[model samples]
Target: MNDKANNIKRQIAITRRDELGHPPLHLDNNSRLCLNCNRAINDEINIIEADPACLRLNVLTQSASQTCVICNAQEDIGRLTIHCRVNVFIEVNIYIPDNVRSCEHHLDENGMFHNRLLPGLRFINRPYLIKGPQLQLFLQHLRNVSANKVKGIDDKNLTEDEFKCIAPVSKQQFEELFTYCDPVYYNGKLRQIKRKDLLMFLCKMRQGLSDDFLKIIFDYHSRQTVSSVAACVRTSLLERFVPTNIGLQSITRENFIEQHVTEFANELYNPRPAEPKVIAVIDSTYAYVHKSKSFRVLRQSYCFHKNRHLLKPTLIVAPDGFILMICGPYFSDAGNNDANIIREEFERDANTLREWFQNQDIVLVDRGYRDAVPLLQHLGIDHRMPAFLQRGHRQLSTEDGNESRIITKNRWVVEARNGHLKSVFKFLGQTMNLQHAQNLSGFYRIAGAILNRYHPLINMQDVNAEFARQMLQRSTVPNAIQARVEVDNLRLRNGQWRRLYGEDVPDFPLLDLGYLKDLTMGIYQINLAPSYIQDKLIRENDKELQLDEHINEPGFLRIRLFSRFRNVVKHQIFIAYTANEMENIDNNADNNPISGYYCTCQSGARSLGTCAHVASVLWYLGFARHQPNIKYPDTSLLDTTLDAAYRQPADIAQNINVDVIDIN
Candidate 1:
């Protein structure tokens, strides 16, 4: 049996070498004669003498050991056995088919010749060095295995939600980007992972998933490989996607004016005559980072406001909430404040902000950019910011406060844009590793680019300039009730202003939500009114309500309600109700039963519409109270009565020095 196997192995080696372009070796006549089988090679048959060195075979003798015909026949059977094993291994989905064998040849009890090898030789345990045709076959088998594994990803087998969880874009969008990027290789090899899978890696990174978790989900062999793949994908996205979609240079001034600027042209306080062609809102957003080992870095990144290590990146967004450009991910130190960043941008002309911004082009900002105002003025750029309250004053004067509201109303979009970027890319929300601190800017820019291209406009529709103008006009109107309250010192005199409670709740004019929205000029405040009212009612234990009936104005009530935000502060508001004759209010008519209202809240002070505080009082008094036994939901999580530090103090009333007006 061993001799037969050896003879078969020799024949296979010779045949493989011949197929590999090696000429057949000549065999001597005596050497072609088999000693044990007693068969001689026929002269008509061509056969090669196997080289023991090349074949790695143990030949029993130097010559006449085996006949070429017997070897040839054995080689054919061996080849057939290997092919059968290969098919079985392939069918069973074996990744590496190293062992293949044929059945042992033997005589059965019935004297029939059964072609099967001995039991020991039937299945080979050793892996042979496969070459030539066998090597090609093995590679082809590997190809089949890989194809099956990646078939699902290539065919987009994942559902929409599943794809969304794994990638920022939809499957269709991913495919389109993949085609555009055409990333063919990664880590110096032909990419085994599909383009969608690569993008999934990037998306998962943005979602702030750990490498270990990603590896388990993506079926990666190691976390290091996952990191490498993610890095490669990030590089590709930065090189291929970010440039065209982000940065000031990517967009033309004409396009910016046409698409984003024109909408705010007629907006209140839009810096006209100069006819501000563009209005860009700028603000800095913080990204928390792990404390660094380097003391200098740790000190520089520490933010006094957040009480943590943070990186602040300044974002400039168009009125439509498009992120036009991203500036330095400057350290949170005082030197890198928003104003300083803008100053540096002007000095460096970063993204050509100085060149692109024309004279009288408006830059809407928060008070943080107060220092930049002088610089902007020097450049002939108009800057608008919310008015800051004087050190002792409780609120800005009517005109100053109203103009501040206009600035705030327009500036809020940039804040929303910043929030959108952080919310969509959770990595920015999480505390970043110290090691990855340098990559913060790259990630920020990339997230901004993605948002600019995919997210809906922050301000979905153009600002209603007419509504804004009306609001501006309303803001300038002096509040007669507030004026009267202040003149009579009604807030300080307890007898003049009685605590308004359950039975004292005045009759407020009933108005529908549409009418309320029209009065407020937006639904946000009206929608928030319920939650604010509920918070005052349930969370603050309804302890902050007061009414002044001393004024001779009939059907008018002056009340001071505790501020939802500040424990020690309260806002004075006025509500005017109509006579019973106006009970049946027409929804479509401009004239409503609610004749006039005012609240000291910045927005409420505006004449165009009422603030949420005034709206809440009217809704609760007129509509909500009439719907008897209906439970109002508590929308606030804060327990101001219990959680507030002032509430905890035993002498809280004395410390605050304000009357603890109680509401039943």
Candidate 2:
């Protein structure tokens, strides 16, 4: 009986069917194909029933559909499909259905949305279906992306101040520079990265950080990666960016004269020029480098003047502090001095520099370029340099001093521009590595271009036009006070002078900042006023004589300040003023109470301006002492330290014994 029943059941199971003449339980939702695909019902005849063996298993699927959401490509669905991630929707604000398929070409190898194709994402309003594991995976991935974005040197991660502090350019300037960079590819890896590499290059220039440290900050895999990135960025900038911003070829001589030339420069150098001629200041700045193992390179790079191994890059800048061109960063040896480097630059005519500079153009330089003056004259270029001290003269003559002051005032722009360059790109100022020595030219060019494009003009002429006119007017006046001192032989006699205090002189002229600035014609001396006064007040060594203690007579003050370079030498300073002057007067007024000033410094005899020592004395007696609770520079740290060069072993032993360590 059991055998007959089993045979009947097997026959019935083999022939099992529903009302639709299909397999039994064929109407189940799990077997529904028409809902998942928009195919005809008959085409769904090949649908296989899903096994219900593990009802709790939640396996992740590639997508709910075979078509790519990005490009709508249907072929090779299984091989080329990339399931969209949660970050894609969050970043682009285009909803990507969970497990939506995308072609491999549409996404980056990192499985992220392509930057170029992200905007083309099709709109989808369908509800998302995510399994538990998929949701958990997405949450973890999002956490990682967020953390990396914050921790890495990404543009979105840093604030405007942070960008300037790290890189030298503002946030907007940094962003604007991206348009000039070329987009390179790692197509084999299906990844495209940029901008951050440019930023890394800037950071390298601005902070002067080592490759290893840069690698850590930028999340690069190794120091070699950082170096390669820097190299690539530098090349890109040199080719695409630098040519349009810096160098002699970038700007025309006519445009430079019209746009960059300043009134002060014109009046000081050319003096009401009839023809359009270029007036620029030229100078060289040192870029310190590490000592090399090769003796030849060491000999070539060593600078005896600066006492360091370095390179010299000659800068050509307009009087308004606009950089016009940069020349060779030649070796720092004797053969590659400033004059030779500049002479070579002119001789080579690189980038048509010789053509750019025409005849009658004035080149303002310091005394170091004296050898190049003949060459400049040969080329029909007028050159103005500071006057060299004659062999027998301890001081420059009045005419030489006046002419040199005008040249120095115009030449100051180049020095200020050099300092600006170092401040912006610290790599130029700092001691660079030997590995970077070969790329110094490219580095300097890039730095100059960026500085020109982004930074504001330094030492603008409009702010100093009146001041320059005043300097010119003052230069013509004779030093009446100096003549009087010399005629009376006041400097030779000490018996005529009497020791007196500030109260003893009841008629000294009290001055304000503006009057003092007019007397000096610049702020450099005023900036040093507090420090000089502080030096006297501190009295580190009591052997020095005080200026206020030896006033000679009413309406006159005299003092001596030790030479900065030589302590054994002293400079005599004298100031004559109207008695009973208790208030400040207009700096431009003719009836000024302070009649004249004189000093024994090399350039002190010039009536155009007072020497630093004279300015310090006048500033203190007339202005600084009258102010209450003035905060001077702190010198406590310096006072505590001893000079290693002058320190004796016995003195060291005595100090060390008092603070000796007790290891026992």
Candidate 3:
């Protein structure tokens, strides 16, 4: 009889324009004992009913309806009824997702409410204009609807089918599942999605590249924000994925020995080598740091080591054909010597280090690491750095010298690893700073984690194959040993080339030197070593004496011209060299007959220059003359620029040095 009476029209009350200034809270059912924030309003309960709770009824005949009431709400006598009853009240716990957080609502026992903003409107309805992420807004709306407990609408209650949204789950259930996580307090960041939804998505993908796929869920975000967030997450999640001591502490020596070492060794030997088997190699690379702002004031002096331009980090690595160790990057203040870095890395004690050695652990370090030999022995590490006679190391025996060359020839692995590490993170070379220190350390740890995901350059099969090949070559043809003998014989026939020219070379071909040219150039940036490395061996009872120090040992060792060609044969330097590296040709001498070929120094292999030694060796074999074809540079031929009259411009020469220089 009263089905039409089921159509409940909420009472609307319109106040006069003069009475529109009161707070809407005064129109509530009972302001004297109201705790609206913590109290829920539900209409049409089984015992009672609720509607028009969230909405304040306002009836207007001729004037605009306003929401205002007197202190005595029941006595106001407005043209509307402010109904507050329970229609669908149900006591239940909430189950909020981890990503969804709840706000704290406060209402005093005396029915008064106050907060930084409004009591119940915990967060501002900012209405994120964000495109793809309307999910947050959807959740917010559900909360608003649930707080008021409005009656449900079925298919017949709505006019349009498409407008019919699904029924919202109970809000209490969601809240029970997740504790509110205040993102502001957590960090100055916001959660873009509900925790439950995010976890669900992650679980669904179940792959290593979950972050890449996260873009789809947040496509509505601004492109710039999205990209930045993605990048930050990439770096951040790297820590999450890989347990490192800096972040989650996940690295140890066991992993290095079992996983990384085996992986690297395999790769080195699996592939065929061009010549003799490369057992091990050693090299050093420099890591740089930021400038010191206080240096000028505190130090009151500018030293290259501590100067603001750059700091130094030197690394000793095993870079042979196989698995290499990131041995020691002796980190220090700027303006430190390379040799000193080596001493630090080896712990300054010879006998103490011998315990860390594995079988066949040949160290291919630079001559700067000479002091580390005694320490290397302690660990059973074979130290095979090249002989820099001028720097006062004992002269190499014919056999020892050749062995050094062989080790160096295969020592390019350090350079490659150094290149990969520094290049991937250029900021490591920028001026060191407080925050940067943390970042750099994190960078190294996170990078290792990323590397683990991908396959290493080495593998077990590869190691086995390479090991087999090396064994075959050593038994069958002995490439390095034989080459060394031949080179020594050549030098013997030619006599010593060191003192033959005995001239300080000021102007060598800058273009001819390749790799070393660049390294030297960089060292020159901080004034490391810029000039030619001169050398001559003096023999006393078959022992050798250097200008700086003499090591008289019982062996067939003699100090002759430390020929520039020495390095090129097996110690192929990848850069240009100064005249000191060659025959030291005099600028005004008329006695010496100059060679007409490229420099025999390793520098020639790196750049376009030829020192006196290279020139002499090539001339003896007649390779300096121009030869047609084979343009990569003939260690055997020389193409003269004699056809042109003008010399290289000063700017070009200056520019060349800069191009090659890199600071340690």
Candidate 4:
């Protein structure tokens, strides 16, 4: 077998050399004018080879004079003029003269013009002859180029960062993925295109670069060839790679449960303590596409909610952020909401999803899948969704709010999974061409499969397990502080308000990062904390408004914050804390000092997680004040960069004036 492989390799090499039209080795000792130095060309002289094909094809070339060929500069620019090699001979079977010269700017970082035809190169008519060392140099250049072209994006050339940035995978992960492509067959030949083509395809997906750009990057001859290679790789991966990593058939239902099921999901959504159910979070993400020429397609892809032309793909992810399945990049038309799309999946029974779903299995979804709740029930699949407000209701009840928080806490992983897909495979983040509409589904599915197969789980830490337990413990707890504030009519009636600053609230509970995370139940609210506090400080400094304090009850503090919305409403936040009267008590401790908290906002009264308003105050008193020189992002520049448009008095009066004129 080894002897046969050697013979095959030898034959392939000989065939390539023959196809290159390389002349057989012959002795030629004739001295000629060198293209590089304008001197005699011999075995001892190093003559530069210019693109001679430019002369035959009438393409652009620089003068044979001493000045830089590209710029035609008369005066010396203090830059070295390089004598480029005969890439033209490799290109169009034409020999470049030795007298041509070009500046360093035209050359790439490798000091060679990478396969591209340089504009300033001087081409000559005569056939360039070389002997001994010159001929050996030419052959060596050809060999090096061939080797580099074959090597492509292998581990030897690129660092770990470069590999990950280009292919979004480590060298180790790339090697494993290459195993599937190494045995790839094309036209009845095994390993026909090699793993280099696989790297090209992955680089395209990760960078979202143009075919032309990718051709230049990967050293391909044409954009058409690049497209062909990508197509071949896509087909190969879809057949052999995607099926093993993603979709319902990738792993058994039991195996998926055992591997990807999270403690948080189990504790939050599992109704039966005896039986462990498959907890999956379902969500839909959109990929924006350019407007199509066909009106029907334009209408089909237009999404009214987003006010954009896009396609929607439904992502089903496990609680541990493992992508279970990706379904339909269906039209973003009015008819295809998350509910409709999911219903279609069940109706069509795509990938045996119906069979995969067990009776007691739980699916955590947002309000977008509310309409599909009845269908989930009919299919014997348990689904949990956030609570929806009635038409007249201003806020969710404490019970409803807490339940919604629990559902959302588990459902957030699907969103993270979607974000991961977009971040790693940047192709999905941008507005894709309408020409690729047919391949959009394949692109997302392939990306999903790659992420599932190679990437680490989003929430795999032991700390998450502890956080989950805390969330479960607080799931049924009601907001007692919220009830007390409502009963006492604290919001309705005005009290003698005192201005509250960080220094004034010394008795307030001090919070650390971990405690803040526990209070919010997620980093999202904590992230918004600094910005909210900054806004409050700016408002206080401007004398427009301040955080007004109303403290009638001991160890209970009340402060009102302006709503983040455009409305002129403010939410009254109440925090019940133990006063730090003892001098020996640890002020910076991460213990539960702020015993109870509540706000009157829509989802604020939840015991499971505090609202952003309450979180902001707590973050300021406990965290932000403790840290010195906490510089928030300068958002004031946004106001200075552009002015908000104000309606002209004439424009506003135009409609009324027209009405008056018609009446007259």
Which prediction has the highest lDDT against the true structure?
A: 2
Give RMSD to native, each candidate: 13.9, 10.9, 19.7, 15.2
Ranking by lDDT: 2, 4, 1, 3
lDDT of 2 at 217: 87
List per-prediction Cα lDDT, in the order shown. 0.62, 0.71, 0.32, 0.70
User: lDDT tens string, model 2, 324-414?
Assistant: 9888889999999889989899878845877888788999888989889889998899999889799998888777788898887667888
Pick by TM-score: 1 or 4, better one: 4
* Number of the predicted model whose TM-score against the real structure is largest: 2
TM-score of candidate 1 versus the correct structure, residues matched by position? 0.71
**What would the TM-scores of all predictions be?**
0.71, 0.78, 0.38, 0.73
Q: For every model in order, what is the number of clashing pairs?
A: 9, 0, 95, 6
What is the clash tally of candidate 1?
9
Q: Between 1 and 3, whose lDDT is larger?
A: 1
Ranking by TM-score: 2, 4, 1, 3
Model 4 lDDT tens row, 78-120: 2322224546566555444445555554453334453334433
Clashes of 3: 95
* Candidate 2 ranges beyond 4 A from true positions: 1-150, 184-193, 460-467, 536-545, 548-553, 643-664
